[model samples]
Target: MPRVADGSIPGGPRHVALIMDGNGRWAQQRGLPRTMGHREGVRALKRTIQAAPDFGIECLTVFGFSTENWSRPAEEVSDLMGLVRTYVANDLKRLERAGVRLRVLGRRTGLPDDIAAIVERAEQTTAHNDRFLLQVAFNYGGRADIVDAARKHLDRVLAGETGEALTEDILGAGLSTVGAPPVDVIVRTSGEQRLSNFLLWEAAYAELIYQNVLWPDYGPEALADVVTQYRNRDRRFGGVESATARVVG
Candidate 1:
């Protein structure tokens, strides 16, 4: 493995998106309230973020709450919202001190005023950090993101920017994840194989890996193992064999 000056696995992917699933199932398996599992999942997220740099991950995007999640029980949704507030309250200072820049992706209009304020505070407070980027996809959906991007692009066109032709770059620029690098690998925990409407556009060519471990049980070891799998794969961005593409069985 290639190592950086700080002994990090420099050969690993630049960005890793995680589908944090199975929290409720985990709690159910233990006969505990599903909300309890979400709390534990938050702790797991903390651990993973702290360990990401060591595995060569510059940006980590995690799916926290999806747009479709609103269909779930009200109590569950409230609990989920509470978890976000608790996480920010307990970890924001430490994350800022660690040089981690935080960005919460997804629709902000529907969020409660307090949550919206908290989100803004988290982003602004850590805006200066550059050591790493953490994007939490809350109330986000892949299809919805595409539509939002499309709507923004349409608005620009309607506003007499007709001279500018529509292109992939034009549409991509409107995405919530526009500034972040394209995802290198997308991992779904709890043995799930589906993207579940998470980072659809950004993950166009990202390698997908599903882990048997649940989200609450995930940690550095699991992340490192996924990076190893990512390293062993042959990634061809539509072209044939190239010098940079690895051939592994």
Candidate 2:
């Protein structure tokens, strides 16, 4: 692709997703508790949110806690839940003031009552904001999301909502990320290369970038580097090459 005058690609990704990994390893390397690493990771999340708009990203999604995480030690699970409460209590006001709509994508049925309340409040409070979107995937799994979406479609059909058959659009609209844009790029930290059941359907055409930096160490520079790599990717989306691709090839 030809570079723009500013030495950057024009019309950069509008949506970026991240798998923030290596927190426990980062703390273990420092002889600190894993919880400490999680705290620092929260700081990195704040920095990323502040920097995303600068890169022309309108929506940022981060995988926080996964459904499979419940199998970890009880203490760690409790700590993770605590972190969710603490993050919302500390950041909700600032996030609302900054016009960042926060959407927690995951199953709510199994969430603790208090944490569920906080999630509801955060989403309701910022429902009117439109400046940016921050989607946190907590207690989420890509396979589970797909199952939930399928159930939703089946329920509608049983309720006689429509006689039409299920299609991609129909199923997609039933996903937790219903109104959100398709992910443009998915970045995994700590050099991990797997999706880890994050955004399965939404990432069908996303550019995947892996970074060696640990989650606590991630910031604007790391994301910027990811975007740079994303720019060089030739995204064909299962179609023929574009005019730019032909010229560059």
Best by lDDT: 1
Which digits, one per residue and each the tens of the lDDT, describe model 1 over residues 62-161? Answer: 9989999999999999999999888899999999999999999999989999999999999999999999999999889999998999888788789877
On a 0 to 100 scale, what is the lDDT of residue 161 in model 1? 74
What TM-score against the true fold does each predicted structure earn? 0.95, 0.93
Cα lDDT of candidate 1 equals 0.90
Off by over 4 Å in 1: 6-10, 242-249
TM-score of 1: 0.95
**lDDT of model 2, residue 22:** 90
Which stretches of model 2 miss by more than 4 angstroms?
A: 1-9, 243-249
Q: State residue 128's C-alpha deviation in candidate 2, in Å.
A: 0.7
Residue 10 lDDT (model 1): 42
